[model samples]
Target: MIEKVKGILAGLAFRLIALLTLGQISPILSACVIIERDGKILLIDRSDGLGYTIPGGIVHYSETVEQCVLREAREETGYDVLLTGFVGVYSSLKRDPRFRAVALAYQGQIVGGTEHGSGEGSTCWQAPGDVFGHMAFDCESMLKDYLSEHQRFS
Candidate 1:
């Protein structure tokens, strides 16, 4: 149909623009959370020159979101996590440094491993709103949405 063709073209055009501007199509699959316990959330400080951010990273090829979160948690926080569900998907050009990324933010709970910062930075626990003090980017907007849509958070 003509409408279908137009939709396909529109999607193609968007992809082409993103690839051209960001250098490459960085298919990043990341996740984060507004982990709250006793009215506090967990956060991290990424000294990778990218600044502090909530704990997460790229999802490996063939890995599911739950698997990615568990792996990333271990790599960054020295812990394994059990994913409850997705907070939401965040794919924005201005949020990250390079390519536009599709981050599958999930709600997870820590299960095991010692609390030691790994990879590119340090980790910490803070109030959900207070996280902005050390946040690397504007992911707080997404986090805020997750908080507001608690019913649909999963």
Candidate 2:
């Protein structure tokens, strides 16, 4: 299954990251967007078995965070979204278990494209209140901050 493959790949990736970093606090910069439609938010049922994660991923060296957000949103969720507002930056040490990742969160709305899932996972829409415990990483925290209408730096 794809999930099993992801799990195996994730294990390898995690170990490789840890070894390369040598246990240093080398945080990765990434961007994500909360794309809303009809009062529901887009969520990815990640194939890595890490539960649901918002559509996002590590920023490439060639792109800005804003560009990365747009690219990642389209790649993961198969929807083109326009950034409406910024959610906040999430940089907690525990934000991700595989590696330290700083999330540059933003609010967005669907602008184009069809619905589909990438190698990341399938896409689903859910109410903010309905996605509490099923979320992975610091995604739940990110959503809470966004819903509360406040900027967060955790």
Candidate 1 global CA lDDT score: 0.65
Best by lDDT: 2
**Cα lDDT of model 2 by residue, 1-154, tens digit:** 6755765676577668778878763577989999777888899988877788899888999999999999999898888899999999898878877666788899999899998998888999999888899899899988888888999966
lDDT of each: 0.65, 0.85
Off by over 4 Å in 2: 1-25
Instruction: Give the local distance difference test score of model 2.
Output: 0.85
Candidate 1: residue 20 lDDT (0-100): 88
Stretches of candidate 1 off by over 4 Å are 1-26, 150-154
